[model samples]
Target: MDQNKPFVTEFLETYKRHPALWNAKSNVSKNKHLRNLGIEDLLKVCQEKFKDANTAFVKRKINNLRTVFRRELNKVLKSKTTGSSVNEIYIPTLWYYDLLSFTTEDESGRVGISSLDDDTELQFT
Candidate 1:
């Protein structure tokens, strides 16, 4: 087991719990008051692990991780369109892929179904 695995896992779990971090189209993510909570979450984790952690350092780290995740996810999604079969689709090799898969959920595409009304009609026997 890699020594850094635990650290990465911890941060990923933290990111998952904070919807403002990954669910870009979510109301919480878009809200000015809540959007930055992801950064705050990471800052807390970093400060606890490394006493010297600062906002700039944590922000940069989070951005880099997000960039990597986006790139990797794009590759996988692209493969689905280009590949002719399941065997040809790209499989993520990064250990963090599983942890980051939650980001693939498209929150923006979700829609609510409204109830429809039906007019009653009289029938003759």
Candidate 2:
């Protein structure tokens, strides 16, 4: 065991569960590909690996770790794609950016979908 680990120990423990390995090869096969390896599902799998040894606090801890990576990745992606700003743009509702799914959705109950109109498009929650 290395001391002063880069990640919190709980996550390391979570990572250790079930030989938690993935690679591009796993996706090349004629199967579900990485759907089972979705990030949130991976997080849940991490939770399950720890069993009751870890709690929701650990879940938050791990999510925070993920959030940091999401932020940095978003920056790189945004820089590559470029963005536009108008004096004013109408959103018409509260919106959330789901980094995991790359989807955006309205918090308020709404039935319509929207577009970014930007060259780079990401899926929204």
Candidate 3:
């Protein structure tokens, strides 16, 4: 077996123990809440959603994830306004575990996951 497999497995197991980290129902519910909001309102919603989660660790992780989300959305909006290609946007090099499962509407304004599906949009709000 690979030397890193056990460590990786343990990490995944530890992560799974946190319900708020990848709760699909919660994600979908939040996505619904986000669908009607504009960008700034969306950022506010993301900040508020995880305010009451059980642990400081989880709260901090959620906050970090929210920061990435806001940054990505800002990039997308800037590119759109400048009439630049959306492909110019790039994902940050940091890892946020499976928190990347959130979804974002594409440049044409359709709400679907794209090749860059970093979940920057759906993860927080």
For model 2, the stretches where C-alpha displacement exceeds 4 angstroms are: 1-13, 16-53, 83-125
TM-score of each: 0.74, 0.31, 0.33
Q: lDDT by residue for model 3 over 1-26, one digit each (tens)?
A: 36544443443344444433444444
Clashing pairs in 2: 102-123, 103-123, 103-124, 103-125, 104-124, 104-125
Residue 89, candidate 2: alpha-carbon lDDT: 32
Evaluate residue 114 in candidate 1 and report its C-alpha lDDT on the 0 to 100 scale. Answer: 48
lDDT score at residue 121, model 1, on the 0-100 scale: 59
> Which predicted model would earn the best lDDT?
1
Please provide, for model 2 over 1-125, each residue's C-alpha lDDT reduced to its tens digit, 9 standing for 90 to 100.
24324234444444333122222233222234333343344466455545554345444654665566556556545655565354233222211122222211111234666565557778789
RMSD of 1: 6.8
- lDDT of candidates 1 onward, in order: 0.78, 0.41, 0.45
Q: Which pairs clash (backbone N, Cα, C closer than 3 Å) in model 1?
A: none
Candidate 2 vs 3: which has more lDDT: 3
Model 2, position 6: C-alpha lDDT score:
27
Q: Which residue pairs clash in candidate 3?
A: 102-119
